[model samples]
Target: MYQTKTKREKIKLFLIILIPILITQVSMYGMTLFDTIMSGRAGAADLAGVAIGSSIWVPVSMGIVGILMALSPIVAQMVGAKQDQDVPYTVQQGIWLSITIGVIVSILGFIFIDPILSFMDLEPRVQHVAKYYLISIGTGIIPMFVYNLIRCYIDALGQTRISMFIILLSLPLNIVFNYVFIFGKLGLPAFGGIGAGIASSLTYWIALGLSVWIVHVVRPFRKHHIFRSWSKPSFKSWISLLKIGVPIGFSIFFEVSIFSAVTLFMSVYSTYTIAAHQAAINFASLLYMIPLSIAMTLTIVIGFEIGAKRISDAKHYAYMGILSGMFISIFAGAILYIFDDPVARLYATNPEVIELTKHFLFYAIFFQFADGIGAPIQGVLRGYKDVNITFWMSLVSYWIIGLPSGWLLANYTNMEAYGYWLGLIIGLAAGAIALFTRMYYLQHSLQKKLDTQQS
Candidate 1:
């Protein structure tokens, strides 16, 4: 029997694992803030354009990223099973697959940018800006996909510190690029929102290059020969990846589509309302990276533990990760609530925008708790290879319940923006409940299998 860890040992392990995750999240939020700040300064139209462009762009990109993310759990399982020699081949397959998908997505995004912008009914200026941003950013899809593949491989190897290190090193360069590109500094023409997009594209490629160098040429992973020839993509590996990844992709797509749809629906409101909504969302999303990173880490950890057949330990780690997320979110929510005004003011100057944003901030604070709880639970479920339930739950919660509720509340009720926020809260709550229930059932099933085998 495995020995139970002492409380101190548990705490130490948690801290050691959690700190890099926290740093990585903070770095991601820093990047978001940089984007927002540069876009906001470009002009309100530019800000609105980036917001809308990202609403669509992020979901599509994340959907593919979710598919690529299947590599982590699969790799983790291999690692846990002491099949380390196969890791490089798996990583290479993921790299090739992600690049192929990225090319297709890039083509679609470039071709449909104008159509999507027109459909959103953005103001004429906002539409033009958004179109430019989308086109420019679309060029970076391959780099983004490559970066995620590298990140997943590194993370699955339990070297999350590399991601953190890269982010820290790149952030300063990103800020410099943003400043030069956005402001026409050093003889560059001012491209406004397009400049921000260009900077983002360049930054992604730079980061990808650095990551590749680190993984391939650096001391540790260099020995692994990540670039070495692997058995060409097998039908078996592709099927395995698809079986695990499609559900995860759909789950994330469902949740993200609801938000994108909501944003589109809200455009029916005045521009001020949409701006307020975007600002509030920007802040909330920044905070959300914390739980998101933690959830991703837990997914890796739990998958590794389960692959080793340490069933109880896997369950314990997942629960502990959830508890840690909840505690941190509570404190984060309180801080956000207290500083709501300052946060809103940072993004917008209009009194109306500020007022609406404050209301959004209030709701956002409470929503974070549900978000924190839900993300890690889903992560654990994904780690357990139980993504089918996640897909079903997300479809039910977001499409069937969340989207309709938001539309009805926004259109029919006296509370317009608040109604949408309420819908989001309800959706998150439902998602949290469903994910937790699924996780519980998975753990119970695993325990039964273990018992039966022992008997």
Candidate 2:
């Protein structure tokens, strides 16, 4: 039977999930923040190289991460429905999916990475380092995806604290690795921008190794007998995961690629422009973690309700999550807007980079509302196994509306960097509206059906 949770109880549960996930995300981004700070210290060219290379790597890797993320809701629902026996088999299938996709992507990313960098309009020096950075990191793609698959399984089991602690551990370890490789500390050779990539590669591996140890040794996971037997890859299981996963992957791809595309467009300007763009966007992403973590938790929470055959309860708590996200956005936006200058100073030392980031930050601040609203709604919908509409909606909002407008404004008008950010505002807003509308309609439709069944 589905256990009923009070409204206050739901909010409390949301907080329990939100804080650890937030720390985990913060720790995850802490790695990037460290890389960005270190890159800035290296040189403008080093910073730009990392930014450009990240533009390529982040989106490509996110596509795989997004697809694998489908595992969260699936596993959450299964656990909720008391199909605990299926969890281990489901994990095996996820591993198979990760390995299959990981091998292909890692190979292609390595072969094509240099050629792609060669075509970009980067400063030759920046291009050279960016190519090295991509290659250094590209080799670790499979391990990273496998780690994410592991993370999904653990988080679905309400063991979020495990992922949080592991990421926290990786932060200091990554810094040490970066120090040794990037600065020739501790008898290591200085690799500069490439060193950060190498550090991240090593960090993912370390974290993965630790995760395996924790799962095997920890008392909680041993109960599942998750590793007692390995299941062969099944085509049917692949199709099942892919059906829900592909759209999610594409949706994230569209969103992240558009942002990455803007970074490429920024390259047309001075190196400082791109560096400043990187700083502002990275800071914006930090604030975005609030809603994003909340969104991730909503999937598990609402999926649990759905699996327990509590549609109304799922819908109720889903709104609570969405509202919480919006509330947090208001505070986060205010903080960014009010303290923009000091925050920009944290990423860069140059006056021009600082000023430019300050100006562009307005759009980033304004869009948080839309991002917050859209993000959690989509998370709830994912729990309901609804993704196709989101994929199509994102394509329209980001590609059709956001990127083109950004390009036109940055190129044709005097907006330049400012224009691209303005386009971000519009794109985020459209996505928010579309998602909200879809959820509203679906909720009422489900309500009517439930009412009829009762009658």
Candidate 3:
């Protein structure tokens, strides 16, 4: 419906989409950031405990995120093609899918959490906090999934600000909840690190409630009748979604689980090592929101363009997004390099932890450089529906190449925890190169098709 005939127009529209999404992504991620910061204030043991628990939770939750992300392209294409009637059904099926997966993951999380934590051989206090942390957060899985699905639908329609508004409302509440439950205000016993999980769970439910109300009240969203139109669950529809979604889910799982694996592996080291590693990783994740938001917007913009049969425009958008990501990474790296000490102190008061965190932050600068390029290419590929290859690429790059190399370096050499971060840099660089190559191939192939048709 909007025109993007010139590069200027495209950039303008991209900013329009990118800004709200940036706010939403940052606000949503802010919960985790606050969790780490607040838990760190409680004690090094608590910080390490939440870090361990997050090592378990993030991959599972993010995999679900990737799966539900299929809805973005699905609905974006529908809107672009003016298949308005079909949008509601697809969105509805997505909700059904979310609910089913949420329930299953929650149940499995409760069953497996104790055993997983036990296997880690963490310190007793750390293990107790980790176990109960997972359990507490497990209660919110359903609402989180459902909320994310609705958010995807809204984003695909280019109504990103709605989701932004919803998350903004929830962000403050999360901090308040954390303060209350984490510190044991109002005459309650302090839960220490486990309170972060409890706060996050409550935040999820609140966000979901806000999402439902907003979607029902908002004009274009309500026009789709996502609530009023209910169709019975369709296995065929589920299959179609899984066809696009499962590979994405697994791809994200492969990438994120590498981080979790690193966290678990770091546990064998001293508590200072674990806490420092987590602080660095957490800060890196926060910085990652920039490229990540750009990549997500790329998915929506490029998907809509592809659906509207504007392959040239989609290609242009892809180039713009990937370049912007790289440029931003350079800026971010400079900031991290300059402010490493102050940033480390933000997470911990201990001099040892702070020093170790600075070392890790130095390593993270390289990690972001690779991720800046690789992450957006993944989003562009998703817009083209070229996903299966990404899954294999992630597995090979992260698990096969990255993890083993880090283990060898950490265990066999003097680099220690720093070795693992160097491995991440290598893995991410490899994945970025492979993905860029893939994106290049697809762009030319699509261009040829478009040229032939025009001729």
On lDDT, the candidate that comes out on top is 3
Which lDDT tens digits does candidate 2 get at residues 1-455?
A: 13556887777777777788889988888877888778877878888999999898888888899999999999989988999888888888988899899899977886797778878788988998788888888777888898898898888877888999999888899999888877778878888888999999999889888888887789677777666788889989989989998998899899888889999878889999998898888888888888889888888888888888788888988888888888999999998889999988887888988998898787888887788898899888888888999999999999999888888888899887889988888898999999999988888888888899999
TM-score for each of the candidates: 0.96, 0.97, 0.99
The list of candidate 3 runs beyond 4 A from truth reads none
Rank candidates, lDDT, best first: 3, 2, 1
In candidate 1, list every pair of residues with a backbone clash: none
Residues 1-455 of candidate 3 have per-residue lDDT tens digits of: 36589999999999999999999999999999999999999999999999999999999999988999999998888888889899989988999999999989988887887788878868999998888888888889999999999999999988888889999999999999889888899888888889999999999999999999888888988888888958999989988998899888888998888999999999999999999999999999998999999989999999899899999899999999999999999999998999999999999999999999999999999999999999999999998888899989999999999999999999999999999998998889999999999899989999998899899
Error of 2 at 177 (Å): 1.6
Q: 151 in model 3: Cα distance from truth in Å?
A: 0.3
Residue pairs that clash (backbone atoms under 3 angstroms), model 3: none
- What stretches of model 2 exceed 4 Å from their correct place? none
The CA-based lDDT of model 3 is what?
0.92
Determine which window of 10 residues in candidate 1 has minimal summed lDDT.
1-10
For residues 1-455, write the lDDT of model 1, one tens digit per residue.
01235656555655665677678767756765777768777777777777787778778877888898899899888888888888887888788788888888877876887777777777988887778877877888899888988888888877878888887887887788889887889999987777777877887888898899899887667867897665586667767887888899888888777777778788777777877788888888888887888788887877888788889888888888899889989988997889999998888777988898898899888778898999889889877888887999999988888778877897899988678888888888899999898888889999999999999
